[model samples]
Target: MMFSSKKRQRGTLNREQKKRRLFLFTVILAIAILFGDYHSTIASSVGKETLTMITSPDYPPYEFYETKDGERKIVGFDIDIANYIKKELGFKLKIAQSDFNGLIPALQANRADFVMAGMTPTPQRRENVDFSIIYYEAQDTIVASKSSNLTKPEDLSGKIVGVQLGTIQEQNAKQIAEKVPNIKLKQLNKVPEIVQEIKAGRIDAAIVEDTVALGFVKANPDLQFNVIPSIENASGSAIAFPKGSQLVKPFNDVLQKMKNNGELERLSKKWFSANLTEEPLSTNSPPAASKGLNLDFRRIIPDIPFILKGIPLTLSFTLSSVFLGLFWGTALSFFKISGIKPLGWFANVYTSIFRGTPLLLQLSLVYFATPQLTGYDISAFQAGVFTFTLNSGAYMSETIRGGIQAVDKGQFEAAMSMGVSYPMMMWDIILPQALKNILPALVNETIGLLKDSSLVATIGVVEILRSAQIVGANKYIYFEPLLFAGLIYYVLVMGLSFAASALERKLRRSD
Candidate 1:
């Protein structure tokens, strides 16, 4: 009886041990799978060459986002061509996005391996970047309100004609302006923005590529486009690459092959033949038909969720920048007041340099130059944070210096008399008082950072403003969405102000 009881106990213990081992094995397998998946998602595969392609996706039928079943996918003719080339060259392709004006700068900065945004190869552009063989030739069109009846370049005399900045169309408009009398030109950043100006009656007409204009015209029944007569040296789009890139020849070879195999024609027909004018006019109508600052906020109702999603990113960026800037600024303030000559001189020079230059220029330099200077491809968000931190630190250093100096010298002497070390005294006693004195200034700086956060949009950080821009581009209306974004900003700033004021009162209680 005793032996049987012992045998039973031994069997139970063995079963428990096996269960424990199985549990641990399962956990280990799960962790391994998660780590492997994350690594593969973020980094290129080993021994597989990956090329980064940059483009402006607002150009439909070339590259644009289509939301289906709560997922956004970039689809169009250019994407098809890129996929074909990637397969032919046996290289993995990753697409990066930026504003149209920033694409060339991105290539110069080595931020992309190639550009395929239906870009033209002009003489000025050839000086900076190499080009593949022309794949598509597009005609210029004069797009205007249907009632305007403005049909030709000659009709643009004394009229405010809108064109996208840094495009072949803008250059074409300039040439026309020189020959046509009193042709006032207004350059915007995107084709949709130019179209908006026409709808709002702020501009008489806009010059856009025909394929792009067709998409807009179909969506908006109130608009019409007239094809401009093709002149010598007409613009044609080709792939753009960094100067002397070896991939240019391979890309051109694949393009030639596609042409020979009828693949190019197949893709062109697939994208171009599809009617994009399916958007219901009643639902997506613009404010043009109404008089005197008309707005239909209902049009952006569906996109509200998309635009609101940017708030978290904007807030995170601002808070991160402010915290990092505060730390750096405090350090710089110490250096400025250290009584060490070299440290003081270095701090002074740094402050002067940052304060003298424009913030936008600094942002551009950091975002575009960091990759070339250090082989690390700094993302748009990182570049924005780093640049804002550095720039804010310079200004805050001066503020902090004043605050530290304004602290009663007797407090420091008293601490020293109590045998407190200088660093400890500053950290525990001096900084507390100095911070109180500069709290208002710091709040002002925070507010400024919040507003300046919009600048990151230029470098492709899709914060609040960029989200609004994307919605505007998709809907083909400017003022309504932009005004809505302004309302959001105003509300945010007000809320921040209220919170800061409450904190100020709470801090005053300690006094």
Candidate 2:
């Protein structure tokens, strides 16, 4: 009996030693990966001489996609001005694009040196970022279908008025709503969407800038716009910089010189003189979107290659997020089952925080708030991967934990009986079986990530949806590109489903 007792003690001591070694290995590896990732990011930005300017690029005459000679590039009044300033300031310029609403957050995140999206410096916006002197002023116009007869702000009473979300026109619409009783405002992300709403009769009218309205009116002959007579001289467009940015003074100086020398007027004439902002890749004029879905697939044929380019980026993002999430989730699962109070509590709390919050909110916080909170200047791609990893880890930890627990508990005892170390048994014998049990769940998560990859477009990662939006913005038509994008997503998801099913069959055959 004493001999047996000694043997048991020896086994216990061996197991404890193995646990310690496993823990040490995991901690060291995690540290190494994190350090390497952060270091590489820092290194990439160290010697860069380029300054990034972020903009929405959907509003033509200010900024929009100009497709010519089978190449699409952002060009307009704002693009010219930004280029001029870059030349004068002796800095290479890199233009970045995002949602109109996301422009301020990009600056706040240090993601851009300045913003020139025909943004006006309202008191509310001024509180967040510093602005340059007014560069160009534009009047707001009420845009509606020809039959609506809603030409004035007073004419909008009891009618629905659409405005681009986060624009000065939205604020102006609110002021109009205050005076015009029963007028309701509907907000959309882009001017094209608001104009489409008017054409579709979803909204009676839209408050759009005159220069922007010109493009839509020409594109959709059914629409008409009348300028809203101003109560105050309109606050004109200005360049936005992060608070306390040194570039503001220099940017303003260049703008002052441009104004004095008539450079700004020259650019204005170059873009604003024409209702069509771009040289269309194809001369085909898509039929006006009628009451039914009148899709002109030919309109986006020239842009199909552009949309297809995003596939690689989308795939890479999904795989990277999946791999990172799997690694993190595996660790979190071990922590939860480690049988230590602190670790279990930490794992549970972390999972709860991530899982309970909306993924969109989490993504926005990580992309926009990380730089402010951590000073990391994380790229949209990096921020997307990191946020998705954390969020996916939370969900997957539970999935993994269940998988691990589903493995016959007797197998663990059997391995322990043979004097196999706990870590060795767990890694070599248990995890393989556990993962097999959870194969379907993992595949589902992967498919979900593939679809979710489109979310990166909001922060400017130029994936499939953003590519389609760019095409729409350039063409002044919305549905065809979006429908085509939808088709691409459907095809991708179907392909993934087939691959996963085949993998499942192969694994089942092996078993």
Candidate 3:
């Protein structure tokens, strides 16, 4: 009886201990989760909603497109960090691509929440946007032909040094020029272009970042890069947001956590090990430019479908722009002859400004300045279509006005003699004749707009030119893919021409 009592007491004690251990484990887990949350976003949830980020994906290891197993994804150090932060903050992340020059503009237009393109935060940039704490440090390099022996900043004296437009390196080159004599800066749009210029001897040297320069030199043994000595304010890449954004504090918090937990170091190791070519979309031999631009279409066969995907987008943009331009142009033509001083003056001034300024300039202003000036988040597509429409309207309005005036005055008199209203007379008698007269010119305008659609690539529209650029950047080759894209544009234009000719015949038959 004593043994039985002792055994029962021991059993009850064991059960109590088990329950206590389980309760303790739960408490510990809860605390750990709370601690993680606190570290992740400063204990506040900036969670939910998808955030869009803009980056110049041409810069690899930082952010570039990877094609694997027939699937394409944007993969790089920045993308990984972004994903981790999104997971921590409980938000979905969408990445958008743009030219390096367009990255800040995209942010200004609210086309993206932030930019992470290995971009250094310079004073000029800080004036327009806010930046998070520095995440990675990179040095500028002077890349030149091994034979040119341009290793130092002083060596670039009396040389045409190339730098990418709108880059911190451009600012660096200017500073160097102030110190070095006779340094003529030649600004280009891409590093690849700068490399070609160096090879062609058009430019003696280029100011490129060390990480990017490393990959270029490796791909082309003919070139070498020497790191420029660190500058006074040796700043590094930080996440950039629109000026006065609410996301500034939260992004900074997440970045701080990444720094403390060594996440940033881990990413730096993964990406900084090699340059862009380490993640080539094609495994074939590199382009044989040394052999006088030896063309290789086989290397891009795997990427043909990718480039073809741009067709639909191109068509949509072109059609939308052309139709909108037609409508707007017709309105402006009416205003030109409306005899209302205010409307005429407004339309005339509008035409003069759009006509006087370059289309590219107008597009940039509409895209970058719209958000700040209007507080509306204008998208890349919207900006492209709107700019094209306005430009086409400026040109088409004059054509339309000429077509309208050329109509026989007797027709207006005849319509009025029939007791027709002014609106009815203009709509029925004047417009039909004017449209017929301008049909060929209208077709020409359509063709012009179709070609001009390539400009949208500057602002990150994944149309023909941008897709070709992506493939070329991935393959470390330029000419073949661009030729193919040009061929596609040619075929499209030819098809459009055939269709227009057939439509003209049909309209003549109807008459």
Candidate 4:
């Protein structure tokens, strides 16, 4: 009887405990739900609607690059106006980044709901994408070297002009070039490159929107550039909504309010020094007749003058690292090939660490952290060059090792049988053949260095991308300037590609 009573008590206690746990869990879950709701955005619960926003964070004073500093937070006029629209309509805003040309495709593919990258609403772009009410007015301007004698469209005759790809300025420059007969236009992806090229005298002049031209001039006060006062056609910049978006009316309503309430003017003054909200669609305005100077690209290919000033710095850094990498890679390859246990193991570990990690991270560590650790400070450019070389070396080592191993063992032994010195044999025979096998890859690495040089911008090398950003931020036409930069990069990459192809053909013929 006692045992039965004890067992019954125990069973009751277990049931009570289990019930208590269940009750606690239910309460906690309810609290979590309430907290989530409390923190939810106004449109979080709204179903069947999402506002997808795409932008490139390369420009400043408009839509500059976002950094971890929270200072890089989106505070430009675009964000302000977009938020106002979102508030009025009660739709969630989803933001993304799209390339200058990719914005429309993203909208078409349903990857983005809209684009707000300071896009100028042009007739050609309208064929593919729908734009909302014009939010700002803009004009095209020329950026040129101050020393250049170009004063008018006719002055551009027989000069090299730079412009952004896919922009009204590019089209205008082309039209003017066609009419003028002597001017040549070089279209690029980013504006900074144009600024740099102009400063370096790579191009005689660059055509950009007025705002961006102002930015370039501001950044380079000592760099003389004349801004012709005669204005180009003025165009309206508008938020491009996806085709058939219901959000357009709501956005337009907010934009009208912003314009009416002077909020738009306030933003424009804060960023652009003047209001661009009025007369947003005056694309037929005359070209700038101002006396401002800008970049000139009129000379022969390679812009020999600028190339002479800057390409040496660029090539010097590249060759120094490339040659160093070749030496280190060869040593590592030999170690890996030696069949020696510890040396091979060490070489493998070295290759894996560098190959597995990002070059940017390594650059930061070496450039920023190395000073703290080793008490030696290196220039950002040098660090960038060194980091690239080291990274390339590790990858190249594997290529070299593969090539070395690929050579027939019989050939090596035949030289040995001839009692040839090992060093002489390698120099006369093995290295020559191995180099032939690896020449294609070496050339690829060189081309890669050209692109990677842009990364130097992160550490402040003012290579093409940084120069574009500096200029874009000056007047807030981030898209146009970046487009110019892209053109420079494209031309460089294409030229290198052509050379690589020619080199490959030559090698094949020799073979």
Candidate 5:
């Protein structure tokens, strides 16, 4: 009986040990899966190689976003071509988006392996980046309001014509303007913006690529496009790559293959021949000009949710930038105040550079240059935070220095008399008072950062302004969404101001 009982106890202990071992193994496996290097795994799973392609997504029949089931996806002819080439070359594809004007800069910065935005290779562009063989030929068309009857290039004489900035059509319009007398050119960032300008009577007509203008004209019943036949041998769309990129030859080879196999023809027919008029029309068509300022806030009511979604991103960006900028600004303030000559000189030069230059330029440089300089594919959010932190630090450092200097010398003398170390004295006795003194200035800076955060829209961070722009583009209406976005910004700034005031009042209680 004793031997049997001992056997039972041993068996129970073995089972318990097995259970513990299984639990421990499961946990370790989970940890490994969670912390494993994703980049390599993703690359291996997807393909042997990965390449980034950047494009401006606002152009349709070329590249644009479509929202379905509440998720936005980039689609169109260029995307189809890109996928085909990616499969042929056995490389995984990743896409990044930016404004049309920012695309070439993105290539120059090595932010993308190649660009496929239905771009035309121009002499000026060739000087900066290499290009693949022309895959598709396109022509410019004049888009105008139906009543205006400005169909031909000659009709645009003595009138203002709009063109999308940094596009082949813009160049075509420039050439036409040279020949046509009294023609004024207005450049916009996106085709939709140009279309909006036409409807608003801000411009008489716009020069748009035939395919792109078709999409807009079909959607806007009041608008029509007429092909410009005078400009023969019009620019053809080609892929762009960084200067001396190895991918150029391979890309050209695939493009040639697509042409030879009639694949290019198939894609063109699929995208170009299809009628885009089936897409839903905007509910907010403008009233007749006789009706004064016929505004429709109801048109953008559904899109309010989309615009509101940007608030969290805007807040997160602003707060993260402010916190990081404050930390960096504090460190820089110390460097400036430090008696060490090199540190002071370096800090002064740093402040001068950031303070002197435009924030938009700094944002662009940081977003584009980081990948080329460091090989880190920084996200839009990360690039925005880093740029804002760096730029704000310079301005804040000066503010902090002034605040620190304003502190009475007697406080330092008293602390030294008590044998307090310099570091502790600053940390405990000096910074608190200095920060209190600079609270209002800091509040002002924070407000400025919140508003300036809109600039990040250029690089495709969908903060408030970018969100509004996207909605404006998608709905093909401008004023309602933008004015709503402005209201949101005003409300947010006021809330921040009130909060800062309350905090200041509380801080005063300490006195």
Candidate 6:
């Protein structure tokens, strides 16, 4: 009986042990499954999180690109609002900066998550983008040189009207000009440029947003222009989103919260001196009677081949200019450091003029006006490269000079003591290390030149931005083609940055 009881006890113990092991195994498997699912979902979501946004930093009071300590940072009322909405909606913000006209096309290609450049919710813009609540109110006003006779928008007729390309003010200015006849449109890139152009007498008058015009006049007391009490048009600016966005509700919800919390009012007062937040205009307008989002994207697709043909020319222009800039900049740097008073002074003056003047003006002089002055008819492509190279060289000379100066004086002395000539000492010992130190700056400058290369489009160089504009004009769908152009630029810049970082890392490792 005792043996039978012992066997029963052992059997019970074995059964309990088996049950405990099975439970532990099941728990481990469930945990593994849960972890795998979570990780996979995260990976998948990351892959799907491709959101794009387009903006131009040149529009102040709304958007501005700023550089601090050599790092590019975009800031403005529009940027702040966009960032807030992006955070609220739990989406990534990929910002692409460009001329104002490029914003709409950027949206059409699913490249821009939204455009938050304080763009007015125009009937025309409504045809392409889905707009959120109107964020601010602006009245159109005309600004001219303080000395100009322009008193009204009517006075702008038959005279140069400098307006930013994509603003409702531009359209209003055009409409008003139609009444007077033969008004010339001199579209400029940004507010600052518009003011500068008017100040420089490049344009007779500039039709601009009232707030912007006010700011300009206040800043420049000497450059006076009377505001035309005749308001061309009044409109509310809003955040633009791509059509059928799931993020729209979340964005609007957060925008409302911000408004109620007085955040919007605070920002408004901070930027524009008044609270302008109001319920967004109705976006639910039955998708326009026009085909697919009121934009015919297909019309432009046919030009993709021709546009692609320009890529090689663009690359050639970039590479050639960069090469010439580096070579000429190095020579200029040597001349500056040579201590030869006349040569150094000449180099200094050259650098100063190129640095102070706008690249666009330099390009114009090179391509359009230089022929008259120098009696040489330069091709637009050649002139663009020439101007860019010279401008880049001037900027790079300063960078190179700084890098060389940063190198220890002892290195140069050591090479001199070793019986090396001045040129040999610079090339063999100093330049190698100086170039290494300045390599990152050079790469960054290259990226800048790449972006600025779009300026060449103005001279009819059929580059990416110009190509997109052509496409936009043909299709009347402004956002998609511009979006594609911005994407191309962003990808190119990112790739260049990656390469620079990788090279830097490799160089550091070698050190």
Better of 1 and 2 by TM-score: 2
lDDT of 5 by residue, 38-58 (tens): 545544543347789998877
Q: Write the per-residue lDDT of candidate 6 for residues 157-259, one digit (tens) a residue.
A: 6798888877887888778777878899877665666766765668888877765665556544434444455444556777787777665666677888988
lDDT of 2 by residue, 1-511 (tens): 9999999999999999999999999999999999777655543342335789999877776887765443558888899998898777666788988899999988877888889999989989989999999998888888887667788888999999998889899998998898899999999998878877776778899988888877777767567778899845374899998898877777788899999999988888787755445542222344344666567888888878877778889989999999999999999999999999899999999999999998889889988888788888888899889999999999899999999999998999999999999999999999999998998899889989989998998888888888888888888899998988899988998998899889888888998
Per-residue lDDT of 1-511 in model 3, one digit per residue for the tens?
9999999999999999999999999999999999777655642455336788889887766777674333457888889988888877767688888889888877767778888888788888999999988988888989887777799999999999999999888998999999999999999988888887887789999998877777677666567778899975463888899898877788888889999999888788778854432642212333334736667798888888878888988999999999999989999999999999999999999999999999999988888888889888778899999999999999999999999999999998899999999999889889998988899999999999999999998887888888888777766677888999999999999999999999889889988
Output candidate 6 Cα RMSD.
19.1
* Top candidate by TM-score: 2
**Backbone atom clashes (below 3 Å) for every candidate:** 0, 0, 0, 59, 0, 12
Clashing pairs in 2: none
lDDT of 6: 0.72
What C-alpha lDDT, on a 0 to 100 scale, does residue 341 get in candidate 2? Answer: 89
- Report the candidate with higher TM-score, 1 versus 5: 1
Model 2 ranges off by over 4 Å: 1-49, 67-72, 233-235, 276-290
Q: What are the per-model C-alpha RMSD values against the true structure? A: 6.1, 17.1, 8.9, 15.5, 6.1, 19.1
Q: Candidate 4: worst 10 consecutive residues by lDDT?
A: 299-308
- Which is the better candidate, 3 or 6, if ranked by lDDT? 3
Error (Å) of candidate 1 at residue 226 is 0.7
Q: Least accurate stretch of 10 residues (summed lDDT) in model 3?
A: 280-289
- Cα lDDT tens digits, model 4, 207-260, are 777665655565464333333444344456888866777656666777898889
Model 1 scores a C-alpha lDDT of: 0.85
Q: Candidate 6: TM-score? A: 0.47
lDDT of 2 at 435: 91
Cα misplacement distance, residue 423 of candidate 3 (Å):
3.1
Worst 10-residue lDDT window for candidate 6 reads: 279-288
Question: What lDDT would each prediction earn against the true structure?
Answer: 0.85, 0.85, 0.84, 0.68, 0.85, 0.72
Residue 65 lDDT in model 2?
71
